[model samples]
Target: MAQCRFSSSLLLRLRSARRFSSLPNPTTTQNDAELVSNILLHHHNPFHAMESSLQLHGITLSPDLLHHTLLRLKHNSKIALALFHYAKSLPSPPPLTSHAFHLLIDIVAKVRQYDVAWQLILEMDRHNLTPTAATFLILIRRLIASGLTRQAVRAFDDIETFVLTRPTAQDFCSLLDTLCKYGYVKVAAEVFNKRKHDYVADVKMYTVLVYGWCKIGRFDMAERFLRDMIERGIEPNVVTYNVFLDGICRKASLHPQDRFERTIRNALKVFDEMSSRGIEPDVTSFSILLHVYSRAHKPQLSLDKLKEMRERGICPTVATYTSVVKCLCSCGRLEEAEDLLGEMVRNGVSPSAATYNCFFKEYRGRKDSESALKLYRKMKEDRLFAPSVHTYNILVGMFLQLNRVEIVREIWDDMKESGAGPDLDSYTMLIHGLCEKQKWREACQFFVEMIEKGLLPQKVTFETLYRGLIQSDMLRTWRRLKKKLDEESVTFGSEFQNYHLKPYRR
Candidate 1:
């Protein structure tokens, strides 16, 4: 019986080695690329030409090849599932395994096919495959990311039932981190309390719970945990203190009208409290201090802290430098920002997309699209990193401000092709920018596309489009949309609510 067992151990290794997307890997050899393209060309074939390609290559179905092909075709679920079914039916080496099923399950889950995902999970039993912790993590993380926190909780519950094993501390910790990071801190606290007795509660576990409360700016609850943990004899660590410090800054950010000096001073109190407790500040603590000053737009103070790090023989991270860079950029000190950017690169620190975005924003402000696009060209040549959604959003906004609709459209398509896909902000900015340019029909098209993609447009998005159509005497278009809403679109949770149109002279 043990001899027939199959798992995702090798599959996990393969997955870790590759990026997750439906795009072909850039590093593939010409021959391998040709084979992938050939097999994918016949993706809709019922007989599964993937097997024929394998036979032609005289290569048995290996885990590496299987993982590669599935990821490459992830967007085409029909072909990916067909490949999975063919692999399962194979009576030879590389027999049906948990990895194939899990990968397919994740693919379906990405498109919100939860029922199909659950069925795939159940089907694993027929193959004598046991779902592992990684499997549940994928499900839980995706569900939470999709704003289905309750469904994530259900997946957490199903872990013990499906895996035939008890949930580990790591599983619980991961769930808590996901939930808290996504603003489900209350639910995370409930889970922690519900299972406190199942394992030996330690400082780390309590710290996770404390971090969750502090994460959401619930200092009262966080302090309660500190007292409770101490009473339980579990001492708080530097990380626990750092959570409070970070939370203080996060809370300060919520009220932009507050005095920057007062906010910065109050945020530093957390660090003072840490020292009073005999907890020495670590690199993270200094990073948080830099964030404190940066958040208040105090670039010189931020730079002072960077110099202090060197004076104390402490090495600063790329993020540390980026904070000052960002602060300088926001303050219109582009030369200083550039100096720091070059200094970080000289120190062998690679700037992230966020670091690059600071410069783009300054150029966009100065209407220097030439310099912005030039920097993007350089970024395209840099193989180590790629543009992310934020980068695309900046470009979209920059082009839209110049009324370069065609260029904005090209950027929209390019960002989508890059595979990060548009988030809510992307769609929102694009639609409104189109409306501002009197492109009502195009704006409506994107608004509906946003809805179809499972992203709910803001109330303001609908209102802006409505006003644009009405003010432009595009009543026919407005009537068409209203009819569509009345006949079909309202059922989609009335994504648009009842709002006063106010589309005419009052």
Candidate 2:
């Protein structure tokens, strides 16, 4: 059915091309007609062929047919082809109607061809086809998708000046949504503040702006927006509440000078407000509250919140348990963290890769390699084959610390066998390990391999190798590495160079 619909749409476009060609100059028309017929029968259905036919014949399709074809192609998932054909069929000193250009812009946007869309808009201006509100909206959406919010707003202003249509609430909402998506929450807030009186912003738009501000750690602006929403008699939704909660949690996490007590108090205030407003807090809300409380070293309060969740008939998710486990690990309560992991299993909440990673990191930090390796094996048994780079680095670092060079080589081989080659950090960690073990020759060989693979050694990597060579009293070898660094133009800090020079002078 889908294929039939697509083929039918293709046929309709071809018929339109035929009609367009037939009503023209005879000599040119004959070529267009043959081209159109060939396209309709061609083994490969290239939309570009029709475009080339229209251009060759100087065929200008009527605005209505162009609009209709665009809508049809869009609905049938051939929008890119439609726009290409439309651009080709557009007459020089093009039709004064905005609809043709508007439809073309929209089709280009839907296909995410922003550069071509913008070029077409520029052409529209050259042809004196004024851009409308709908035209600006299409441009705004495409720009936002491409992370060009500033350009989107400029285009919006141009739309207003050229078309004489005032921007609507939907316009402002679209702009705000775009800004928020691209991490420009402050710009979004400014736009909202200036335009709040011009258009009635909805809860969803406010929520989006608030979430954006919160995500980028602009809590002050987020609070102002919340207050503004309340002043406008717009009730906050669950999303709004989540954004506020997230803001408080993020502030607590990032602010070293701010007391955890303040974070805890702020979290409690939000929770109390939700309760007062008869908004039942979801598991995510509970998780944030737990995380903040755990960070504040209020473990009892964190655990109590979990109990509160159960009492309120809100079942905890794996995410909830994972957050708690991570909190325990952060607080150095490894036993408690492990107990929470066991509890998650008992509750049938399957452990995720994050769960294994958190526990494995904690064990490795304590030099409990056996347990960490056990968890690593369990991860593989569970079919989580791609251990993160951090995990691999940790494993390699652990073996190196224990002077287990043979095991490190085995692990490196296994990593390659699994088709997960070393990243810069991976190579650096192994090289550092080799250096610490006084395996200068092996380290130099690995460095050569890294260079051959086009991996540039980090500053610390060179420092490690240089230090190893100096300690081994291999000044000639160190000079060779120095020459390589000079050739590569790897900048060594004065402090590092001076440190190296001190030993060489001795």
lDDT of candidate 1 at residue 234, scale 0 to 100: 81
For all predicted structures, in order, the TM-scores are: 0.66, 0.64
Model 2, C-alpha of 65: deviation from truth (Å): 27
* Per-residue lDDT over 425-462 for candidate 2, one digit per residue giving the tens place of the 0 to 100 score: 88888888788778898998888778667677777787
Q: Which 10 consecutive positions of candidate 1 have the poorest summed lDDT?
A: 3-12
**Residue-level lDDT for 360 in candidate 2:** 65
* Model 1 spans > 4 angstroms off: 1-60, 76-79, 91-93, 108-126, 133-165, 254-262, 368-506
Please give, for residues 47-120, the per-residue lDDT of candidate 1 as tens digits.
65454333323234455567767777778776666566666666664645677777888898888888888888
Against the reference, the lDDT scores of all candidates come to 0.76, 0.69
